[model samples]
Target: QVFPAHGPGVKAPSLQDGQYVLQGVRALCLRANNTELVSGGSDGSLLCWDVTSGSLGRLVRTVQVWSN
Candidate 1:
């Protein structure tokens, strides 16, 4: 599940772009002092996101770890 960058105490504004949401998310991790986010999908797709400002996440790169 997606969550606000600052934590649960702070409420986040709604997002408009569909791309802002990561689908089929199985696992997620934060790095680089929370500036970078990586999400692993059930479809064997790994998505790298930029969460620098925490306003909205931007899709940085996508990698297919495995495919049928």
Candidate 2:
């Protein structure tokens, strides 16, 4: 979960419906601007999030890195 480092009235990010159930998170990166996030999951999927939005829990983009 992303936590706002220091804000007077920023709300915590909330999850949206129909989101993926990640098996496990292998890697996580917060963008240099601190407005985006990228995560690689064990399911071979990469998810991108908009950290500036309230519904950051729902992925803005998803990509399958590999398939069996």
Candidate 3:
């Protein structure tokens, strides 16, 4: 769900990319100042983006989930 950076009132953009390789997103959040974004992918990966600079930051941390 790629939402507009302007505000929550605005609608998110349609998914133009292909199907999600992973099934679910465990968590998603944005900086209170709206200068950054974060999301956790099902494939045990975490992504952080710097909205103001339009660049991806380094991975702060990660957790591996093993299928039972």
In order, what lDDT does every prediction score?
0.55, 0.57, 0.62
* Residue 17 CA displacement from its true place in model 2, Å: 19
Q: On residues 1-68, what C-alpha lDDT tens digit does candidate 3 reach at each position?
A: 35444333332222334343424456878979798888675556677988888787877665657746
Model 3 has a clash total of 0
Cα error, candidate 3, residue 21 (Å): 6.7
Per residue, candidate 2 scores C-alpha lDDT tens digits across 1-68 of: 54443323233222333354425566889979888788765555467777777344545445656657
Give lDDT tens digits, candidate 1, residues 1-68: 35555443323221333343433456789876777778665445556767865453545555666557
Best by TM-score: 3
C-alpha lDDT (0 to 100) for residue 3 of candidate 2: 40
Candidate 1, pairs of clashing residues: none
Better-scoring candidate (TM-score), 2 or 3? 3
Which of the two, 1 or 3, has more TM-score? 3
Residue 44, model 3, lDDT: 61
Two-way lDDT contest, 1 vs 2, winner: 2
Highest-lDDT candidate: 3
Ranking by lDDT: 3, 2, 1
